[model samples]
Target: MTLPAIIDALQCGTFDREVLKMLRDGGYRCVTPTLGFWEGTLESLDSLARWRDMERENAELIRIVRRADDIRACIADGKLGILLGYQNTNLLEDRIRYVELFADLGVRVLQLTYNNQNELGGSCYEKEDSGLTRFGREVVEEMARCGILADCSHTGDRTALDTIEHSPGPIAITHANPASIFPHARNRSDRVIKALAERGGVIGCAAYRNITPDWACATARGFADLIARTVDIAGVDHVGVGTDFSYKGDDAFRAWMRMGRWSRQLNYGAGSASAPGAVSKPDWLPSADRLSDLVPALGEVGFSEPEIAKIMGGNWLRLYEEVFG
Candidate 1:
């Protein structure tokens, strides 16, 4: 079967030369590599510089995408287009003007919060969801004006809903699952999903273990079923895949993701002390190169050719066009 331009809406990995080759060889046209989780402005800026250096060093394999056309250009030129995204808005601090500054620097997407509440709003794990703060509303507006896509994947339900209502254009839940299916704090509830769809946003179904409906049986079929269920809730056009694949990270990285220097005590999110690291990736779709395996699995689960194409990358392309253009 002919494939569409495959875009991994969110991938957590070290975009090394090897990973870039894997993604290119795996038939990924464009990928959004998440950056700035628990990072301050200086650190995030350094990360962006590192990505730029990587793009230069591996010019044949990948290029940084700054506009909607860059994605198509990379596809035609046979190079992976990398869209740098911030997993949290902590980098912005109190300076709302930084939105346009980073946008100018090719930061196309930014999530309002990670696992903890920030100046913008509350996180999913927060005991009290502060919802969208007044500053958060301004941030959303500035993001819309700057053509930066606002993501609510790790945001509180109330904050997510408030964001959907406040944003001038469609936003994204870049990497998450439906709470109805997985019952995890990282997953979105039905109400949030419906509101996101109503506002023309897309939810990229995540393939991480803890959020999967059946983690022990994390097969391609199960992943496809997750996508199908999301389609039922948000329609096929608003459903896509965000693998959340972490190609290279140690236990330190995992701990940092959960704890993030905010606490001295370890915080095992989605895992306990016994399993104090990232949940295992699905056995079938485990890495960047193995993403194509989902095509057949999606077909097996009753997705039409066009629907599968949409879920694979077409939906993300449409969203990028609308938001990044």
Candidate 2:
């Protein structure tokens, strides 16, 4: 009856005491929270500094994960591993060398683009899919050298394919669903999923209701079905769960996430501006802690214990070992 060690591929918030308790009580061994979304270099540095202070204060509750072994260490100590990540490369700006700087600072995953095009490449929200630019190719090369896992969660399809083809190692679409099941611009197509698996990448199926076909009405079984569809294309080893849970955000923070000082007007990245509020989570899996509830739901969809273990956490552990080791 014991549960496997769970590593959430993406949880969207700066962890506070209550959030850490929720994750710990909920049985999460590790969680990847973005250090920089739309933040620049100085801002990201500040964020990391704050995290260091948090770790120092709550050493028993959580520890920062630098290597793949660090994840195991956290589990052994019964502490949550904070695998530092970035949802965008805006922190890099025009400087490709910052890849190493961030890597040295304990950042293990970096997303190429958010909702808009940057120096690296095009985003899903871009009017024209620019693919991976020359600068973006250079950034990918630097990321390989730095040993940081590349993520294309919010990137354009062409750009995601280009990243997979260009990277020396496997990349990640750490938080996204299959567009085949639900045709949102933020979702990945079957072509992208197949390509990702062929290149040894992992796609962490997200639980954000706005991206699902059922929207706010999605049930845990429906989310499991989405994972099942992803497994059909990518196989179980190349898929996992990224609930995309955000705890410490009001409507203002939500607005900042969608339109990060980029536009004077509201730019609803996934939701419509007309219906302005935070996107609703599924009733069954409302928080990251409820991730364990999906176990039976996955089973209902015919996933065996080992396969459910892989989808819950083992596959992501393998990926972290290969890429972060």
Candidate 3:
């Protein structure tokens, strides 16, 4: 989850607040990512300055997770652990060596591209992805050397496949959907999804705008349902939770996303689901224990508890161990 979601839950929504309480109450720990905003040579802050400030300024149910043991300890002690991450390579800018710097900063994962093309490679929203660029190839190599998992969530199809096929270590699609179900440049094709699983990689199914079965997803159950569908396609052990929740941005931000602020027309001005069952809002940020509710949803589809566990967070844990340990 992103810092915006955390801050919102802690301050705005009672239900969200209770959701966190329920997770801890149920003995399941919530682990968050440190947030890869305001990164780069300290100049790129102009792009994500406000959001980064929210993460740094706001206090909430967050614990900075910088080590492998930190994750283990979070689960053991019943606290939500955070894994810092970057959604785009903008922060890295021209510094490919910065991949190692981020790794040292405890950035466990990185999405190569965001909504548009960048120095690394084309995004899923790009017009065409002709595999890895020279710089992209180097970035891939650097990430692997640094032992930080590469995320192709927003990468173009060709680039995504090229990186996965050539990666020296396991790579992941941190958050995405099946293009077969929902045709989208941002979604993964079945072939790509299967290839990722074949290499001990996990696909983090996203529950956001156009990523869902219908127009908008308003409930965590709906997101879990999508996850269950992905498990059916890729198997339970090959998929996990990577809800790409960024709820703090307003309508202007939405227009910027759709109008191609990063790339051209990347976001499409879609709103997220703030509450369950909302028609326009996509409930991207669900309660922390929202993962647990996936149990019954999957059960309705005939998935066992153990399988559900893998989809929830077990598989993610395994990948972290394999890559980081």
> Compared with the true structure, what per-residue lDDT tens digits does model 3 show for residues 196-238?
9888899877656556666327665566667767877887788
Models ranked on lDDT: 1, 2, 3
Each candidate's lDDT (Cα)?
A: 0.88, 0.87, 0.63
Per-model TM-score versus the true fold: 0.97, 0.97, 0.78
Of 2 and 3, the candidate ahead on lDDT is 2
Model 1 residue runs over 4 Å out of place are: 215-217
lDDT of 3 at 95: 84
Model 2 per-residue lDDT tens digits across residues 60-105: 7999998888888876877899998989998887898889999999
Give residue 142's error in model 3 in angstroms: 1.4
Lowest lDDT sum, 10 consecutive residues, model 3, at 2-11
lDDT tens digits by residue: candidate 1, 1-325: 6766789889885668888998998889988987878899999999999999998899999999988899889879889999989899988978999999999999999999999999999999988999999999999999999999999999999999999999999999988999998898899999999999998899998877776677423677778888888899999889998877787888888877878888998798767678777676678876767778888888998988998889998888888889979
Q: Return the clash pairs for model 1, or none.
A: none
Question: RMSD in angstroms, all models?
Answer: 1.3, 1.4, 6.1
Q: How far off is model 3, as Cα RMSD?
A: 6.1
The candidate with the higher TM-score, 1 or 3, is 1
